[model samples]
Target: MHIVFVFRYHIFFYTRCSIPFFTNDTFETQGRRHEVFVNKTIPMVVEGDDMSAYSQCEIYKTSLNTSYSALNMPPSNTSTEQCNKWVYDSSVLKDTFITQANLVCKRVIARANANMIYFSGKMTGALVLGLLSDRFGRKKVLIISTLMHVGGAFGSAFATDYIFFVAMRFIIGVSCTGMYSSSFVLGMELVIPSKRVAASYMLDMAWCVGLYILCFLAFVTRSWDMILLVMASLTVLLFVCLWIIPESPRWLKSKGRFIEANAVILKWETINGKKALTDTSSSKNTKDDIEPESVLKMCTIPNLLIRTLLIYLNWFVIIMVNFGISLNVGNMDGDLFVNFAIISSMEMLAYTFCFLLLNKTGRKRLLVGTLFFCGGACILSVFVMLFFDKSLYWITLVLSYIGKFGITASHSIIYVWSAELFPTKVRNSGIGTSSVVGFAGSMTSPYISDLGKYVHGSFGEVLPQVIFGACSVIAGMTSLLLPETNGKALPETVFDAVQFGKKKADDRNSRLNCFYTNDAFNKDELTGEV
Candidate 1:
């Protein structure tokens, strides 16, 4: 399924940044590169007399000529937190983006910004690439996007500076949007509506698996460059596998390319050992009779617009809470790898919960319930941190995990809800718009988490929590306004979407009235005959 490929890219995007956490190396020589570590009694000379032997070089040339003694280095007095150079076991060797760019202490914001730029690119890409998929074709756009992903990953591995690394990450972000949006639309169009929830869960599982794999890879490699290179290499397999997949028949039909669509269907028929049932000419005539409307018309329909606004807010809240929790967890006081692994693993539970409950509870109930749960957990976490003793820190951790679980579930369920809400003519565009709005939340979340640390010590850490909890509550309540689409057929036009819920309500009332009237008539007839 195309979901699998897009899911791989999604996993890669989220997990790649965690590599720098383990791989950051403490500079053995903290200050200028030319500064040599030696015993205090021994004054090593490079090119000058004893008086000015170790004086700072005016030329600032290579430091290879200077004699240094790392073994007799000064005893460490400063804590690792305050020290410019950190002391680690000599056996642990790594090369990472943080170490290469020296992004520690004051420069740590650059690390977060790298993530920010990527989401920003995703926001832009969703709008641009979604339209491209509609105008050109899903297959063509997917290939182009996948190639870009491959190229960006390869380029990022060879980055010489933090700026270049961020730039490449942005490029990768854009490519991922293209691949994800195009492939998701293609896959959903091909599958029957009943199977969409299962398909979504499978893709979500694949994404979770990617994070688990990332954890193992980081443990073994312990080098950012190698990890990135390995991740990039795997995308090549996706590229190769894409060759055998057919263009989406729905997209082809929408574009009036019936011949190509028929051929693709025939290919599937041959594989399944079944005969073709429909003539291409007849299918073409049926499709041609219904003219496709402009995607922009989504804004003009009142009912569609109202529902779209709810979706937009829903997406924004989901992503804000999702990334807000994820980024904040890394900064929590704990083993970085352990924290990251725990957070990543929680997504599996969240998605699984949605899978089990989505059909039974329906989309509206699940989304609204999860959002309220997530918000309550977040607010509770803030109180625990403020009022509880230090020994009860575990309680705070527990609440954070619980909050993440609820938000993660909401994130997974929203995907299915948004897909079901839109009509066929504007589905991709509508989803793309919501995606851009959601990524905007992601783009801002890094800065919010970053600011939370400063607020934690000085301002009670309530600012970020207030924002997170409030957004969750508001978005959840707004969700009640949207229609439930459980077991309903996909709509074909804006008009169908507008009347979908009203029609359901009318049908239920009509059936109930008909039943009562028939019962009364039968009773009257029985009495007269007796």
Candidate 2:
């Protein structure tokens, strides 16, 4: 059930980012004409420059008879006027909101603004829905979010007005955050600690599958509205499946609903063909009187503050770099669909590798390694693009994929690592807060990617890549301060989280003391023997 929900949610959530690429069309000034009757004072041989023939934003008032000494010369006695109409090339894209609403030239910023608006909605949902899930139950929020998601998707599909479409996208973004965060927390809580790494990998694989499905859907439909309608229709099945899924037992226990928690566990055991313990004694051991901690406690507590800040930074960097690279698919020199599909496949491989190494290498070490690897790839790709010839463009693509692989692995690890770091009492809230910060990273990525277009020459091409790579490196170094969470039980309370790393620190100190003592004794024994 969790797998189905994740798979469908990703399809709905990620498709928005890819829509702009299909909808974007090359356009030229409308009603452009040359006056043939104007007198030419001088005659010269001319060569036509097709590239400079037409303006995208402005129309030039000039005569075809204007005198020019050479080809590619600016039209003499010409005045510029802002074009009110445009003729979009519909050869590639049959129809799009950009063409329909005329979002070209000066209005092009609206496209990036729309993406930012959606991410802002995601930020809001992370905070509000995350808190709601912790205060209410994950199941209730998940159900509500599913309905919201479907409604928003349908709204987006049928929207005629550009503003209306943007609004629907925002709603979809908000609902997607709610659905993902609630479902992820619920899924994590349902499983035992030992199996969490595997479960996380499974969820990530589901996401990859959704990406593949999206690529196919986009290819088949070729229309953004049709694609949305199909995906929304398919997502309805997840809502139906949610009816049979149970709430998190861990959440029930955290809220002091031991009877409910035990009931859920007993059902699981019965389904697995094991004898269920009828004893209520285990419930009595827990302190039902203890109140669940709020996310604010993480900020106030000295022990948790640094950890929380560090995790937030990691979340920000991972999301920024990941989305930054993913959104650049359209700008890459190749088939857009093929590039997206290849990147999705790379993500699947990364998840597989991460699953295999997670336990052996531990979370912190693996995360740091992947981040550093991604950063190195991103930085190297820039140099390749700048210094190397165009013939080596394929090498740049390979390096970009390498960066994708590293970030994909890091993305998988962070989800499991952050979940284990936060206590059950405020786990949803903690993740939600981190997600809020992460969404900000995503919000900025579209503009960062647009930097390539605003800047000229090779430097413009590699500027975004350089920024992403630098951030990844900085994040990797900062992550070194985070404690390893592999093989550790999920922290259950604020107190438990506060003490999470203390035992390891103590053990290390003890080992050092023993080593020094043994050395001193060996030195005395050697002196006596002499």
Candidate 3:
């Protein structure tokens, strides 16, 4: 199941970064804001002005009969016209949909729009399919989502029209969310409490491995369509494994499907060489007495409102910062493929460290620490870029990578922590809701990365980093309010979730009072009080 899930996860990052519009540089005409070609250099006029330095969208409406000497001078009173045709630089990225569709200048927003639409689809899927999983079964939703994902991937690969391509990306986004949320919940439920953290880290590590595979595929194929086709073809393998994976016994038991749940447990016991439970009569084939709770219950229920909001905020901030840096890889000073590969590798390194330290440090402290570290690194990079020379740009890049490492670790920790915070009955719903909120961050990330181009000077280069840094720091401070969930059993009900951190707080208060009373008594004895 992990292997299959990893294969499916490969599409997520590829979809985010595969678009060439974000990476390709546009060519502008000299002294003009309009009419320009990409990649192809225009002949320079004798007046020391490069024609390529004109407006990207405007061009002088000059006649062929105009003398070469006139071309040397700026067009005085000559009408400027919008550029009708565009050619993109094909040196780094060849045969991309962006070039094929000519999405440049005024049409460039379409690229960001496509990505936003994809994330919106993911947001929709998280809210809808997450509830469906809790109401139906995880395995059922997983299979259905897997089918949708495969179809979407295929559709994206073969889409000829821009509208069709964006529509297909939307489907891929939604289906990917459904597949991940369902599979993640099921995997978490199957693991014992002691190893749940380890299980969550392993799943994320698999996701990183999938990213590595994606980088390799992108390097080899170098075409968006071919990469999609290849990944889609490989996704078919998940169906084979899906057949063998069992429905989560925890979910089954929570729904009061005891007969099926017990059967699954018995199989596990048998495999482990333990005697099966002989009291089969106790396993009644009936629904649970308690009604299933919806994700909305978290919002309406007074005890859960604050915690839910905090989790949602953390999700939004982490995702925004992480994807903000990731999607902006092209703007960095290095080979695009190598930079992407390095970013992906950083995630793997983060997961490795997360797996090693998660159990030891606990969830809350680790999340807070990583968020702060990421925030500090990002802000420090901005300072370096602002105060230092261009030669020191490499230092900025290294700081940014460090920031990426911190955020990636925080991302992993938050996933495990958020899952632990929710109850089993509404776990998928809770996670789905948080993910839906997070997608909003993902949607805005591209535009945030583009902020550098709009702003002027070195500050422009560091603007996105500044925003990401501030958000991370704020989120880290906010995370301190969330309770730690280490070596604790998964919550099985709303009440359990409500009381998760309160009990520990109460215990600490009682202990403090006890210590004060004992100290007073000792002082009285020393003073010879009766």
Q: Please give the RMSD of candidate 3 to the true structure.
A: 10.0
Instruction: Enumerate residue pairs that collide in model 1.
Output: none
What TM-score does model 1 achieve against the real structure? 0.76
Per-residue accuracy of model 3 over 1-530 as CA lDDT, tens digit each: 11121121112121111212324434322333222221112222232112233344555556666443423543355565666555444445555676667666688677667777878889989999999999999999999999998999899889989899889888888888999989888888776666666787778877877877776776777676787788899889889989878898767766767688768767777776765432323233222323687778777766578899999999999999988777657667677778877888889889889889998999888899999999999999887878888798899888878989999999999888888898888999899999998988877777787687699667887889899999999999998988888866556666556656655434354322121111111212112221
User: Over the stretch 1-530, how does candidate 2's per-residue lDDT look in tens digits?
Assistant: 11111111122110011111223322321222211111121112222222222345554444566444344334554565565665554433445566556666687777767767778888988999999999899999999889988888888779889799889888888888899889888888776555677888888888888888877877776666677778788878886779788998777766767688778868877787765443333434345224767988878876589999999999999999998777766657776678878988889999999999998899999999999999999999988988898798899899989999999898888888898898787889998999999988877877787686699777988999899999999999998988887865556777667667666334354322121111101212112210
C-alpha displacement of 177 in model 1, angstroms? 1.2
Better of 1 and 2 by TM-score: 2
lDDT per residue as tens, model 1, 313-371: 99998998888887665446666557667887788999999989998899999999999
Q: After superposing candidate 2, which stretches have Cα over 4 Å from the reference? A: 1-53, 62-76, 276-289, 452-461, 504-530
lDDT of 3 at 81: 60
- List CA RMSD, all candidates: 11.0, 10.2, 10.0
Q: Which ten residues in a row have the lowest lDDT in candidate 2?
A: 12-21
The segments of candidate 1 whose C-alpha lies over 4 angstroms from its true place after superposition are 1-93, 105-109, 273-292, 453-459, 504-530
Candidate achieving higher TM-score, 1 or 3: 3
